[model samples]
Structures are given as structure tokens and as C-alpha cells.
Target: MSEEDTALKAIEQVVAAVQRTQREKDAEGFLALFHPDALWTTAHGKVLIGFDAIADFTRSVLPGASWDGEVTYDVVHTQFLRPDVAAVKVRQLYTDAEGRPESEGAPLYVMTRGGDGRWLLTACQNTQVRAA
Candidate 1:
């Protein structure tokens, strides 16, 4: 596969892992995708740095939340800034346990290819969509 293809596959896998962890309420598994120094800025404007902090945040927030519908991620774009660095834009949709729409937004993720050539999340920022 081409380098772009490989990167795309890696992104897909990471996204799948994220959804799986959320569904399972596995905070540690979710945070495992992030690098040690990763930074995450949530849609609510909360800034979380480091894997430990992120994991704690997830554990505190995600469990007991009923997620009846799937969390879907639609990749809008992917740009390789360097051979080992990529920027991705994605649209995310979340639904409640009853299948009611919870929220939708666009988010940007910066991923880095580690020494082992596996993609790891470096930073993330959510773009809040204002209602019309």
C-alpha cells in the first residue's frame, strides 16, 4: 500500500479503537492512543494535557452515559505536513441511549507517526458548531 493508504488505514484503526473504548467505558484503552504529552481541547473548551489527565477525564465523564447509537466519524480531509506528521479534519456525531441526537461537531486531530511507524495522537481540538 502507498504511504497515504497506510496512513488512512492507521487513522481508521485509531478511530475504531476510540469508539470501542468509549462503548466499553474503557478509559485506559481510549487514552492509550494518545502520546504521553498529548494535548486535548474539548468542544466545551476544557484543556486536558498528558495521558493520565485525559484518562482521568474520560473515566469521570464517559461511564454511565448511555450511548444507544453509534459515534460516527466522517473524515473530511487528511493532510500530511511531513512524512511522519498528519492533520485530519473529521465530523463527529453522537447519539443518546434512546437514539436521540446528542451532538455533532467537527474536530481536528494532529497525529504523528512514531518510531515504530504507528500513528499516535499528538493533539486534538474540537470545532464547535453554532446552531443556526
Candidate 2:
């Protein structure tokens, strides 16, 4: 495969892991996707400035999150900012326990390729799609 294709595949893998981790409520696994200095803004407007802060939040909330449904992350678009950086847009869906859609989100992830060649979530914003 070409270089760009390989990168895209790697990015998709990261996103898939996100879906899996969120579904399983595995906070550690979810944290594994981030860069040490990553920045994150949640749909509810909470901003997490670094991995430590993010970890604290995830550990405290994920396990007990009622969710009441399944969550999914689908990569809708990806833009390569450089050979090692990418801007990825994801469609986040929350479904009822019976699989009915409940809510949706638009998340933008700025990922960077680490020195070890793994893609890391460097910066991100998760925005809820509110109905007008």
C-alpha cells in the first residue's frame, strides 16, 4: 500500500480502538490512545488540558457512566496536515440498549504520529449535535 493509505489505515485502527474502549468502558484503554500532552474538550464544554487531567476524569466517570446504550465512533473524514499529523473528523453515535439512535456527536481529533510510529490523539473536541 502507498504511504498515505498506510497512514489512513493506522488512523482508522486508532478510531476503532476508541469505539471498542468506549463500548467496554475501559478507561485505561481509552487513555492509551492519547498523547501525554493531549488536549480535549468534551461535548458538555469541559476542557481537559493534559493526559493527567483526562485520566482523572476518565477514571472517575467511565465505569459508572449510565450510558444506557452503546457508543460508536466512525471516522467520517481525515486530513493529513503533514506526513506525521492528521486532522480526523468522527461521527459519534449513542444508541439505546436496543440499538436505536439516541444522540450523535461530531468529534474532531488532531492526531500525531509518535516516535514509535503509533498514532496518538494529540488534541480533540467532542461536540454534541443538538437538534434545533
Candidate 3:
């Protein structure tokens, strides 16, 4: 595979891992996808800095999140600023208990390939998608 293909594959794997972890409400597993200095903005507009802060917030909310339906995260697009950095757009969907669409989120993830060649989320924002 080409270098770009390899990078995209790695990034996709990271995104997939995050989606699985989140769906399972596995806080530790989700946190592992982030870089130590990661920054995260919640769908509700809360800004969290650093892994510790993200962990604190995630641990407190993820397990207790009041949602009846399933949650899904999918990569919508990707733009590479450099060989080692990519900006990924993700679509987050929530369904009701009956599997009806409840809401959606548009998340932007800035991922960086570490020296170890692992793609890690360095910065991210989860924004709710509301009808205008």
C-alpha cells in the first residue's frame, strides 16, 4: 500500500476502536485512543484539556449517560495536513429505544501519528447537530 493509504488505514482503525469502546461504555478503552495531551470539547460545549481531565469527565458521564438508543461513530471525511497529522470528521448518531433517530453529532478529530506510528486523537470537538 502507498504511504497515504497506510496512514488512512491507521487512522480509520483508531476511529473504529473509539466507536467500539464508546458503544460499550468502556471509559478506559476510549481514553486509550487519545494522546496524553489531548483536548476534547463535549457536545454540550464543555472544554476538557489533557488526558486526566478527559478521563475524569468521561468516567463520570459515559457510563451514566441517559440514552435509550444505540450510539454510533463513523468517519465522514479526512484531510491530511501532513504525513503525520490528519483532521477527521465523524458523524455520531443516536437512536431511540425503538431504533428511531434521536439526534446526531458532528465531531472533528485532529489525529497525530506518534513516533511509534500509532494514530492518536490529539484534539477533538463533539458538536451537536441541530436543525436550523
Candidate 4:
């Protein structure tokens, strides 16, 4: 595969892992995708400035998250800032227990490839779609 294609595939896998971890409610698995210095702003507007903050939040919220829905993540768009960095737009959906759409989100994830060429979530902002 070409360089761009390879990078895209790797990024897609990272997003897939996000979806899977969320679906499984595996907090540690979800946290594993982040960079050590990651920044995460939740849909609720709470800002997590580092891996520790993110980890604490994820552990507290993910495992026993009081949601009657399942969440999914899809890569909607990607912009390469450099060969090692990318801005990824993700479509996030929550499906209720009855399988109906519960809510939606537009999240942006800034991902970067480390020295090991492994893609990690660096900076992320998640916004929920709300009615006007």
C-alpha cells in the first residue's frame, strides 16, 4: 500500500478500537488508545488535560455508564497535517436498547504517530448534536 493509504488504514483501526472498547465498556482498552499527554474534552464540556485525567474520567464513567444505549464511532473525515499527524472527524452515534437512535455526536480527534509509528489519540473534542 502507498504511504497515505497505510496511514489511513492505521488510523481507521484506531477508531475501530475506540468503537469496540466503548461498546464493550472496557475502560482500560479505551484509555490505551490515548497519547501520554492527550487532551480530551467530553461532550459535556469537561476538559481532561492529560492521560491521568482522561484515565480517571474514563474509569469512572465508562464501566458503569448509565446509558441504555450502545455507542459507535465512525471515521467521517481525515486531514493530514503532516506525515505523522492527522485531524480526524468522527461520527458518533448512540443506539438505545431498542436499537433506535438515541443521540449523535460530531467529534474531532487529533491523532499522531509516535516514534514507533503507532497512531495514538492526542487531542480530542466531543460535541453532542442538539436540537435548536
Candidate 5:
């Protein structure tokens, strides 16, 4: 596969890992998609750094929620900053326990290729979309 193809595959893996986490409420599974020092910022400007913190946050948020449907992600774009660094924009959509449409604004993810040539999330930021 070409370098772009490989990088895209890695991004897909990360997205798939997120889906699995949603299904199983497995924070550890979600943490596997990130680098050890990854940074995550929510639309509300809350920031969480490192895989352990991310795992803890996920565990706290996912289990008590009663979600009847799966969360879905739509990749908006993928940009390769270099052979080893890439960024992706994606839209996240889901329904909350109250049956309200819970859609996070578009989020950007920065990924870096590790020494093993696998892409791991380095940073993520969510852009809040005001309700119309």
C-alpha cells in the first residue's frame, strides 16, 4: 500500500477502535487508539492529557449513559502534514439516553506515525456548533 493508503488505514483503525469502545463501554479499548501523551479537548474547552486520563474520562462518561444506538463518525477530510504526521476532521453523531440528538461539533484529530509505523492520535480538539 502507498503511504497515504497506510495512513488512512491507520485512521480507520482509530475510528473503529472508538466504535468498539462505544459498543462495549471499554475505556481501555479507546485509549489504545491514542499515543501515551495525547491531548484531548472537548467543545466546552475541557482538556484531558495522556492516555490514562483519557481512559478515566471515557470510563466515567460512557457506562451510566443509556444509549440505544451506536455512535457514528463521518470523516470530513484527511490531510497529510508529512510522511509521518496527518490530521483528520470528523463529525460525530449519536443519541443520548434522553433520546435527544447528541452531536458533537466537528472535531480535529492529529495523528503521528510511531516508530512501529502505526498512526496514533496525538491531539484532538472539538469545535462547538451553536444550535440554530
Candidate 6:
């Protein structure tokens, strides 16, 4: 595969991981996808710095979130800043038991390729998509 293809593939895997963990409500699995010093801003605008804060928040919310539905994440776009860094935009949808949309989020992730050739989310911001 070409370099672009490889990078895209790697990024897709990261996106898949995010969706998988969210659907499973597995906080640890989701936390593992982020870098140790990553920064994340929640949909509500709260900032979390480092893996510890992220893990704390994820563990608190993932298991007890009111919505019991399928969480789907779609990668809307990706732009490479360099061979090892990418900015990814994702659309997240939560469907209710009846498969109707419950809520939506638009998240942007800055991912960096580690020395191990794995993409780790380095910075992220999640925004709630509210109807105007």
C-alpha cells in the first residue's frame, strides 16, 4: 500500500476503535486509544488533560450514561498535517431502542502515529450537535 493508504487505514482503525468501545461502554478500551498526555474537551465544553482525567471521566460516564442505545461513529474527514499526524472529524450518533436518533456529537481528533506505528489520539474536542 502507498503511504497515504497506510495512514488512512491506520486512522480508520482508530475511528473503529472509538466506535467499538463506545458501543460496548468499555471505558478502559476507549481510554487505551488516547495518548498519555492527551487533551480532551467534552461535548459540554469541560477540558480534561492527561490520561488520568480522561479515564476518570470516561469511567464515570460510559457505564452510567442514560442512553442505552447503539453509538455509531462515522469518520467524516481526515487531513494529514504530516506523515505521522492527522486531523480527523467524526460524526457520532446515538440511536434509541427503536433505532431513532437520540443525540449527536461532532468530534475532532488530532492523532499522532507513535513509534510503534499505532495512531493515538493526542487532542480532541467533542461538541454536541443541537437543533437550531
TM-score of 2: 0.96
Model 6, global lDDT: 0.93
Please provide, for model 3 over 20-115, each residue's C-alpha lDDT reduced to its tens digit, 9 standing for 90 to 100: 888888999999999999999999999999999999999998887678878888889999999999999999899999999899999999999999
Give residue 109's lDDT in candidate 6 (0 to 100): 98
Least accurate stretch of 10 residues (summed lDDT) in model 2?
A: 61-70
Better of 3 and 4 by lDDT: 4
Itemize residue pairs with steric clashes in candidate 6. none
lDDT of 4 by residue, 6-54 (tens): 9999999999999999888999999999999999999999999999999
Candidate 5 residue pairs in backbone clash:
none
RMSD in order of candidates: 1.9, 0.9, 1.0, 1.0, 2.6, 1.0
State the lDDT of candidate 6 residue by residue for 30-85, as single tens digits: 99999999999999999999999999999999887667668889999999999999
Q: Which candidate is the best by TM-score?
A: 2
Against the true structure, what is each candidate's TM-score? Answer: 0.87, 0.96, 0.95, 0.95, 0.83, 0.95
lDDT of 5 by residue, 32-77 (tens): 7889999999778889988878778877886775667667667778
lDDT of each: 0.83, 0.95, 0.92, 0.95, 0.80, 0.93
Task: Give the range where candidate 4 is weakest over 10 consecutive residues by summed lDDT.
Answer: 63-72
